[model samples]
Target chain A: MLQIKNLKATIDGKEILKGINLEVKAGEVHAIMGPNGSGKSTLASVLSGKPGYEVTGGEVIFEGKNLLDFSPEDRAREGIFLAFQYPVEIPGVSTTNFMKTSLNEIRKYRGLEPISSVEFLKLMKAKAKLVELDMAMTSRAVNVGFSGGEKKRNEIFQLAMMEPKLSVLDETDSGLDIDALRIVSEGVNKVRNSKNAFVVITHYQRLLNYIVPDYVHVLSDGQIVTSGGKELAYKLEEMGYDWVTNND
Target chain B: MAELKDKIIEKYTSTENLNNGEPVEIKHIRDKAKEYFRTFGFPNRKMEDWKFFDSKPIITNDFKLVTEKQEIEKSVLNNFLIQDLKANLIVLINGEYSKENSQIITERKNLFIGSLKEGMKTKPYILGKYFAKYADYNADGFTALNTAFAPDGAFIYIPKGNLLKDPVIILNILDSRKSKVLGQPRNIIIAEANSDVHIIEEYYSIGENDVFSNVVTEIHTDENANVQYYKIQNEEANAFHVGTTQVFQERNSIFTSITLSWGGSVTRNNLNSYMNSEGIECNFKGLYFLTGKQHVDNHTLADHANPNCNSNELYKGILADESNGVFNGKIMVRQDAQKTNAYQMNKNILLSDTASINSKPQLEIFADDVKCSHGATTGQIDKEQLFYLKARGIGEKEGKKLLIFAFANEIIEDIEVPELKEYLVNRLNEKLEKL
Candidate 1:
């Protein structure tokens, strides 16, 4: 459902993603493992159409359409969601209000009627329970005083609310503890379906134990240099990337 | 130095005369005002308050005199109407009261609303002593100039031992048609002992011509009386507005004033509150939201002249684009004003890199048993918050707009009036939609 070829990107005159190629089909979970400064986060940023990123050479196709031509909002409307590594603390903006506006904006772009208040509340309550988010947190300012784990859970809560076809989790398991990691992984697993996909990008193989991926790819520098089955994650955890990249 | 002073005095004399035809009253206070204006005719960059926003533009621009009366159309005046405010509406076009446009409903025996000229001619002794008594004319040059030309102003009075349930709204509409206009719309609100009332003064202009609105509102709160005053200045972007509201509270009285300035190229609001009696309380709150190349300056002073007086001041502003905003708040406690509780806070947000804010909160206390504190904060939107919203399938435009709206909602939440609050929020969202 998604294709990337020669995806080269730079930010502030510094080359990030030199050249990359990846493909993900429907109903499949792809885990992109890379070291620090390996352009994994840069790839997620470019896919989400963030500003200040210079896409020098790249062809990104989503659902058979060129995805690079759309604005950030338009990209979101077309079912592309990014679970931020660092959730923002927007003071005075209620969580429900922010999520409602985003959902309605995407729905409007898709030529759908705005969701009724009753339906929106029902959806919020159901998805909030999936991530174990407090109702009080939903009414407060978006992540203003939330803990690290609460913020990560809030991100997953929003992901379940939007229900995008392609979800990019950019280091969602980095700062999470064992309990939080389990809860976040379970939340992601509950939302997975045949019609949707997820790209879990992380530096460690521990998160894969909770939410097993169908395919494991080793991303060195920029491109994915190695691809294997789900067992590849455990093998890499035992033998680091240096062991694999030295022979490549 | 003498040449600059003479030039300042000559600027007013060389201008076309508007008072030559009419024979108005020359009271002692007005005579003092004339002398003050002649001595310090026009303010220059030398003055601290007039340094940032000089009044020389109003002096250089050829403004139409009060004698040049033009017939304003009803359609044109509709733009100046705040149709949502449920109060007695009085519309003043170019400093002149328009009875045809004013609506007085259910007037009580204690309330009276009419022109200042009529009040001066009919109630001479009452107007003579009380008029210009509250304002510190010699302290500011524009205040002196406004007092010098006190014609075409409003006079509102509430008698003793009566509580007025309804509010009185005065709409000051400056018709800046064709030429740039200069209008000095003065107002005097007097509340006797045991009286209660609410007054709102709104400033609006017609067309986009360069205009200057210099207004001064003097309020007196007697014993056991209460007055709620709201000054709203939403003039056009090309307009220059300077307003001074002086309030004096007697024993066991209360005065609450809120100044909201969202328009005008350069707007300055100076509010001075004097608690002259024991157990008197005053609250001064202001919110200014500026965009484009607009500039808004708010300077306030709360003087505790007696013991057991309390004053609280909270002023906030949100600056966008290349605009500049300022807030200078001063709180004073005299030696006799023991057990005085005063607090002042001014916060601002710069929405753009080019936007700027200058804030100064001062406290001068001579009383030992007083509780006073002042705080100021200026900042931009949190970057992590912006990224968080964008990641939730929200676009950049909607994200920025939401952040700005959230930033200003802190001040809007203080507005008690439900309809006015909703109207302001909707209007603000409309402005944010364009960005």
Candidate 2:
């Protein structure tokens, strides 16, 4: 579903992602773990088409389409979703209205008519139940005065609503508690299907326990140092990234 | 300079609304106003109060004063109607009230709802006491011009201990289609002790030629009274507008003013509130949405003269294209206002690189036990907020429109008038579609 070849990106004069090559297939999950300043978040940011990140070399292909050629919005319409680490607080935009606009835009991109408000409400109610998000929270401004756990859950709720072909979760578990982690992971597990893929980017193996990955890749500096099965996550958690990268 | 100042006499005296049958009290006030204008004609950019605004374009034009009232087209009147609004409508055409066009449904005996001319003739005692009482005509050139030359405007007097169930909508329309007409309307609203009322003053013009409207409204909220005033200026793109609203609040009174500027070439709005006694709450909120080459300047002052008073001011602007905006908010906490609380905020968004905004906050606090804070911010649409919307599949254009709409909607969200709120949101969407 996704492929990156020699992806080299730089924010300023310094290079962040030196050379990254990763292949993500349908119906599989990939977990990327790294220590501080190891380019883990940089890989996620580069894949999602954020501005200010210059692609000095190489390309990214999603669903056989050149992803770098599309804008951030077009990438999203093409079924690429990025769950932000910190959800932005739009002062006057209600979450329900935001969801409706996003869903209709994606539908419009797919040559479909806009969804009726009644049908949209039904869809919203069902998705809110799946993620255990309060229905009242959807009526308020997006992420305004929301708790940390609710913000993370809202991200999962949106992911469920979009049903994207590929989702990159960037540090979504950083501010969540144990209960919130389980709820978000379970919501992700329920939304996963045979034709979708997930790239879970985190620092600890605790999140991997809930949503087990098909393969674990430890990123160091810029390149992937090791790729192994789920046990590699527990090993890295037991002995830090120093133990893994030093052995590399 | 002499030629420019001498031309003001011929410009206004040419009108046929003479002093014949005018009250002696009204004549004295006009003469006093004329003397003030003789000394200081039109405000220039050199004055401290008019430093940012240059009145040359407005004062140099040879605008003929509106001599007679003209019939307003039914279509134009229909376009200004609020949907599902249940309120009293007062139609003022070319500065004078038209009873045939207005719908005053209230049959209360004590309520005197009519024109300023009628108020001067019929209720001399009431009109003489409150007219030109609060608005400082000796200082402002436009106020003097309006006082010396204004023919008529809506005058509402609610007697003591009465709560008006229906709001009053003063529809002021200028029929400048005939010529380059100028309109100056003076309005006075008095809510007696313990009375409450809400009024909306809307300015509309149907003409392609130049229309200049100089308007002044004075509101006096007596002890324990309440008042809510709304001023909406939506006229032709080339029209020039200068309006002043002065409010006086007594003990245990409440006053709220909302001013919305949607269309104009050059518009200036001044709103001032004086809290005279304790336990008074005053709120002044304004919003301006400008496109093309439109310009709007808003100045506000909240004076806390007594102890235990609260005042708040929030002004927001969205300037697109080459439009320019200016905001100046002043708050004064007198020494006697020991327990006063005042807050002021001015926020602006410049959509285009050429669009600009100048905002300044002036706070003069003399009381040590008062709480006051003021802030001003001017920037483009938040980049992070825009990108977040775009990343959710909304296109970049749509995302920007959404952010701009949300930014302006924050000010409109606090309106307590349901019908006006609905109408404004629809009108705002219509403008945002082009942006």
Candidate 3:
């Protein structure tokens, strides 16, 4: 469902993602583990079409369409979601309103009728229980004055709401506790199906335990060094990426 | 004043003659104002109050004083109606009073509202006593010029202990039938002790014509009286607006003034609040949203002359396109005004690189025991917040709108009037749609 060919990106004229090529089919969870300065987040940002990032070379194809030709909204409409490492705090905009606008915008782009308010509220209520989000939190401004765990949980809640085809989780487990990690992973697992996929990017193997990816890849200097099965995660966690990369 | 007299009598001649209203003219006061204007003529660039906003354009142009001789159509006044509210509408077409579209409810007691022509005979004593009492006639040149042509104005007086449940809305329409026209719409409002009233002055234009408006309003709040004054200026993009609002609060009185400026080519608004006695309080709030090539300059002053007085001023501006904004706020606490609590804050957001804002908050305090603080900030939209919204599938346009609205919600929540609050929010939403 996704293909990357020699993706080379830079920020402020400095090369970040040197060369990357990957392909993932449906119903697959791909875990990417890297050390500091491995260009993990850079890969996610370039894939999401963020401004100020120049793609010097290569192209990304998603669902048989050139992804780089689409605007950020168009990319989102085509079911491409990026969970930011650091969530933003938007004041004076309620989470419910934000979610509704986003959902309707995507629906309109797809030429589909907007979900009724009653149905939307019902969906929000049922999804909130997945991550154990409080109803009061949904009524307040989007992520304003929320704790670190709540922001990540809120991101997952949105992931569930949008139901994107390919979800890119970037450092979603950094600031979460054990219980929050469990809840967030559970929410992601609930949305996983035979036709959807997840690209889990992290610096640790802790989150991989709950989600249990089908493939594990190590990224170093903007390039994946090796690929293996689920047991490679435990091996990397035990010996660290430095040992593996040095041995290689 | 000599310069003004020479310019007005020689360069710009009045084409229309004055109306024969009761033949009761205050030549003595007029002469005194002229003499004062001679000493305090139009301010140059050196003056502190008129530093950023120069008055050279108004002085150099030959703007003839208008009268009610021109034909005015009813279609011009149709768009200025606040159709939803229970209001007493008073429309001024081309700086002249329009009685056909105005009506005053007589159910209220000890209340007097009429044009300057009617007030000349009905409430002469009240008008004579407090006509230009608190206005700094020598400081502003156009204010003196407005006083020289005081026939085209409004007079409002509410007696002690009277409450006006309905708002009295005054619409000043600057319709330029001839060449570039200039209007001087002056208003005098006096509320006695324990009286409560709300006044809203709206400035607008009908057609696509260039006009200049020079306005002044003198307000007096008696002891323990409360007044809510709101000024809404939505002139045409081809117009220039320069106005001054002077307010005097007595002991234990409360006065709140809010100005919303959305349109005009070049606009300068000056507001001053003087707390003359102890236990008095004042709140001055302003919001200006500018787009295109518009320039908005706001200068305000809060003078605390007595002890135990409090003053708060907050102004916010959102600039888009190539718009420029300037805000200068001055607060003074005299030696006797101890225990004064004064706060001032100015915040701005420049959406485009060409958009700019210059803000300066000044405070002069002679008293030692006072709490005063000031701050100013100018920046673009927060990218982190934008990313957060986008992560949730909200598009860029909707995300930016949410941030801008959130930036303005702090000030809108401060409005005490429910109807006005809703109206402001709706107007804000409409303007955001264009952005």
Top-scoring candidate (DockQ): 2
DockQ of each model vs. true complex = 0.45, 0.81, 0.52
Where's the lowest-lDDT run of ten residues in candidate 3 chain B?
B15-24
- For candidate 3, the TM-score is 0.91
Report the first chain's TM-score for all candidates: 0.98, 0.98, 0.97
Better of 1 and 2 by DockQ: 2
Model 2 chain B weakest 10-residue run by lDDT: B12-21
Per-residue CA lDDT of candidate 3, range B45-133, in tens?
Answer: 78776677755655665555554444456776766666567767677766767787777874555578767667667777777777777
- Candidate 1 residue-wise lDDT, A1-248, digit = tens: 99998999999988888888889999999999988877889999999888889899979999998999987778778888998888777888998999998898888888899899999999999999988888778999988888889899998999999999999999999899999999999999999999999999999999999889999988887778888988999989999988667756
Give stretches of model 2 more than 4 Å off. Answer: B1-5, B11-20
Candidate 2 lDDT over residue span B1-435, tens digit each = 434346767665565456456667778888788778878888888888888886777888867664566877677789988888888899988778888788887768778887888888778888778878888888788999888878888899988988887789999887777787778889999999999888989988888778888999999999999998999998888689999999999999999888999987899999999999999999999899999999899999999999999999999999999998889999999999998999999999888999989898999999999999999998888888888887899998788877888888977887777998998899898888988
Q: Which regions in candidate 3 have their CA more than 4 angstroms from the true location?
A: A113-123, B1-27, B38-40, B69-74, B387-397
Candidate 2: residue B20 lDDT (0-100):
59
Q: Residue B331 lDDT in model 3?
A: 95
In angstroms, give how far residue B395 of model 2 lies from its true place. 1.3
On the 0 to 100 scale, the lDDT of residue B294 in model 1 is: 89
Clash totals for all candidate models: 0, 0, 1
Ranking by DockQ: 2, 3, 1
Check candidate 3 and list the clashing pairs.
Answer: B1-B38
